[model samples]
Target chain A: MEIPVPRPSEPAKVFHHSCFAMNTRFSLVLVGLEAEQARALAQTAERHLLACERLMSRFDAVSPVSDLNRRAADEKVTPPDALWEILTLCQGYWRQTRGAFDITLWPLTRCWREHLQRAEEPTDETIQRTLLQTGFHRLYLDEAARTVRFQSKGMSIDLGGFGKGYALESVAVQLRAAGVERAFLSFGESSITVLGSHPHGPAWPVGVGNLFSPQDAVHTFQLRDASLSTSGTAPFNAAGGPRAFGQIIDPRSGRPIEGYRTMSVASPGGMEAEVLSTALLITPAEQRAELLSDFSAVSGVEIVYDSNAGEFVPRIEWKYGS
Target chain B: MDLDSPSLSSSGLESRADRREFLKRLAVLAGSSALIAELPWWSPLRVAPVAEAAADRVRLGLVGVGTRGNLHISHLLNTPGVEIAALCDDYDPHLQAGLARVKGAKGFSDFRRMLEMPDLDGVLIATPLHQHARMCLDAFSADKHVFCEKSLAYTIEECQAIADAHRGSKRVFQIGHQRMFSPAFLQALELVRNGAIGQITQIRAYWHRNGNWRNPVPDPSLERRLNWRLYREYSCGLMTELASHHMQVANWFLGAHPVACTGYGSINYWKDGREVYDNVNLIYRYANGTHAIYDSLISNKFYGMEVQVMGPKGTIEAEAGRLYAETPPPAPGIVQLINSLEHGFFDTVPIGGPSWVPDLKRDAKGTAITHEKSTDDGTAISLAAFANAIRLGVPIEGMMEQACRSGVSVLMGQAAMEQQREIAWPEGFRI
Candidate 1:
């Protein structure tokens, strides 16, 4: 219900545009440029984002990711150079996060979602069987050949959690290369990146909010030349019930983490911020600091919903940096 | 205006209520048959009185029992106070097939013999383009009403001759631009006339298909006769067959024929010794400085077909049955604040939102204009009108003009493409 209010008269230097792509809204706002020039650059950025969706979407039967899921179990398949690079980056993050971040958990996610839809929890045997098809250890990549192979059948990789961040980073690269000095990019409003300082401020002030009431900010972060990502309980559970369940699943337990909690992480790299946000959400609170030690110049915040009262209240549970 | 509840003021409410009342009365008038004759003589909604007796049945003969002819037969069969008296096709298989569908209908190989049936009240000329002019002239000479399937004739002069002959005669002449009777199109036209989308600036239309656009011929010697659409001598191919429907809509909506046109065409994909271009692109400039851009191809069906009538405020996609506003309405307080700020006024802007939500919902596709279900593209309704007009012996207003304008416009497009220059509207062609 945010009304489009008239702007105060100021220098007519900012250009903004939004387009739907990758199952989310991707927006770009650039400062200190003519409207036509900014629009041309935004068009280029949108094309890049659309291309990423074409390559990464698992729902599209003809996408490369779908082809990999269908064929990689029996033979090594060489991917396009860009996809190969992304796979390499994912592998590095999987190892760095100590298996906290995983793309091969689609089988477990599907099992839970289907059982939840049936109004039943997955049987223990079903969970164990699906777990066998997951785990980054079973996925092998040949560096020289730029090929990928999955050791187990029924294994699939879903980039839904990470594709947005990657696309934002890719667009940022394109915009910066085109001599765009100051710009803001947001993906689904959950992940945001800034190219330079704000026009009238030192940094772009972005607020981390209660997931249920997004308009009320619980905390604000000064984002400058960095990206911020948030991971939390979905607005509804898998069966579309209001009683929320966390979307972040613990890889070791093979079950969705039980809580109404959210984690926000800021890092210099878009991919790093996205991975660490989800990784930190499922990690033990005491061990969260140790997880952050592996990355540099990163800040983290964890907010847990206190439901003792009649209404849910978001309270900051932990903070890693000022 | 309160930001929380942004309802219209008293004066605004009064004006809106008055407008709604006016539109409601207009809709009632349009739906009532009693007021149809009082409508403008050129209005498509004008209706003739219905037949009241069994002897008032209009006996009709159909020429060219091809694809279009069969569709017309199906509709005519269901129409009240109508009889299919004769079916004619030079091709024995089509003639026999058409005769089989309509019981007790006499079959003839020559359309002239069918025209000689003195009892026939009308002749439905569904023949190929090259045969339309001759068949229509013959039917008119025999003093029979004519409902010729579209792209009126094969040549400009033939279209003029058909119109000229029908002008002095008491025959009820109608074209096959069924969209003229389409409920959706009528609703779209109503919206346009009411200034729902503002002054018309441009129209863009396209029709696409992925096929060879051919009919299976049992024998090679019947190639030209069977696949008549693929030969230049028989038809104008995609221009007459497909683009004409959209061109008729363009002319009808703009209320004027195009002043001039230029275009390019080529047989790029289906080059199987076909004489017509498989692809065509054309631009028609109107006298009002607006232009209609049109294109058609048989090699790609991705976009399918659509006729988008666009203005500054919004676009009415008549084919898709949707209207998309250029900009969604902003909140009232936001509008007021913007206006104040533009005028350099210091105002307390009342704006608030729940934190961390997406700022706006993206709507890439427009909303549907109406929810009423209609399975008509105007063919059924057009035939009913034709039958009613014939029975009442009343000529349909604007029917001949619609036929001439669209028939001449598409032929001009073909000429522009063939002669490699802009073709003006046919001179001295009165409709």
Candidate 2:
């Protein structure tokens, strides 16, 4: 039986903020009152002008074309301070994740995209070439000039996926400066950040959607000044439809992830939320506890695994209050 | 810690020993007379030199002095006539802490050493779920009175064996379903039994928690196997730990054992090394056609715990400390016909002997009874009764059976959750 969607009696008052570049699927929620502040943050995020944007944006994806196109075309140009900082930050995160979250993997993504499109299997040689030129170490970032040059000619970079969360966090800081105490900002499907508390009390209530069962909500989280992000095959992946590959790609294996039905992360910062949810998807089930233990920012996590009957049942794990 | 009964206070005694001797004699006379004869006749029996029969002061030996056992200690301290004699816990810190809570109590790491105190009158068992049956049986064999915590045993055989042993022993063996002693629950039970709510048809109970148990163990103390509720071997997961309490409530209200019960549970979250389930939902069918639905979760704290008993005439629901009754809707088609009959349908006949509105507007008699606090004073009341019976050498017929039956009630829910199948109690099975 399909139940009618329960909507609030009154219209929800809208809040605005923007940081990440806007596309059909990816855009920042602007929380500040002035549009110009939102636009400036968006520019900083798009050009990797701040290290917060680049360091925060760490994903192996094919979209967000500017960084990938320039690197692939061998365009060595000076960038802004924020962009340089982000690029340098990604290099560190790459090391910490043991090359599991390298951003310079667009060539490998391209190979998978081509093979997926043609319905053809790639040979070991094709996979090897892409892997060689796809590590964070392959890209030499010049901090003084804010210039990025690939040590190997074929290496490329992209930050379309992770940049939104990094940019969202940057925008949240801007919102805090603007004296916005309570707010929620979302960047497309995967990134969401909460500011302050709900007007009545502490903790903003966010509903956790069941990935397989669209009609049901598993649990609601009370978040205050926390960022929440969800990654799953529910949004974009399709076997024979308009969307063939989902947005999240596993850097370790150079493929879109499967197995986990959904993973939602809650943390103090948007970048942490974005990275943990993506990294959690790629990390095998057995090694997940060790992988998650190191990050102090990961406050809580809820994952739904598919059962024999294809039902998604949630498993919740949370750290004690900080 | 010092007080004389109102009856004894009028007559003066010089020293502590003199007062104790006089009080002991008075208690014995009062206890025997109260049981054998009515209050008028019993009062006179206590008029003579009341200084012969002395009730034993309970020297309580506590085992498993941790989170749960701590609460038991606090309650026992408040209880009159209980002297906490010894405390035992594997963790030295907990043992020291438990010893500090009850002044002058001896502390030991091993429970066996604590139980060896010859003066010990009773043993209070609040160990983890797995050790409950063995500890209680040991205490019983030692000729000590036992007060074991809920979910009395981990397995059906253990529950049955303990019940059998308790039947054979002359000592009092009580299971702690403290809510049974709660005034609100007692009132609710009374209201239902008296047909205030007609016949109860269903009961719904839930204890939903947001996060799974994740208390940090001390570094270098990775004894997850010992604190084994997190694993299947020791605990029956959410069913035994939580649902059993409500199941006992339902069983008591229905006044019959369930014919069959079935449920499902799983490790929905916190897929670490723990094998126990994080969530479970069960349905029990009573012999009298009543049904009880129970559920629990370790993922999110949204719905507070509550027990809603539905009857034909009304619904009695209690959560936390508040008891609310939603009376069934007013009889349908009353107002129109009463007005029509009062006015002769058209105001033509004026056939009114008395105004019908007054009868319809009569006020309800307010609440049946009001309780002032949440602490189960019933336990104190029950303990007083048990002490009276023990001192008088009379049978405590209904109390032990009630607790034993509820222990079985707890086991039924556990078995259903563990085996993933329906369980039925044998016909004519008592306690």
Candidate 2 chain A least-lDDT 10 residues:
A17-26
CA error at residue B332 for candidate 1, angstroms: 15
* Residue A56 CA displacement from its true place in model 2, Å: 53
Residues B315-352 of candidate 1: C-alpha lDDT, one tens digit per residue:
99998888776543433323433344344343332221
Name the regions of candidate 2 deviating beyond 4 angstroms: A1-322, B1-56, B320-369, B375-395, B426-430
DockQ of predicted candidate 1: 0.05
lDDT tens digits by residue: candidate 2, B1-431 = 00001222222333435434443444454555323321221232233222233345556788887766776665555444556789988878778888888899988888777778887877777777788888887887788777777777787677777877777567866666655645466557666666766778799999887765655667635556444677777776666667666777787777666788888778868788788778888888877788889888878778867788877666666544333333212111122212322332311111100101111112221233334343333344334333333344344544455555656665676677778888786445545
Top candidate when judged by lDDT against the true structure? 1
Interface RMSD of each: 8.6, 29.9
Quality of model 2 by C-alpha lDDT: 0.58
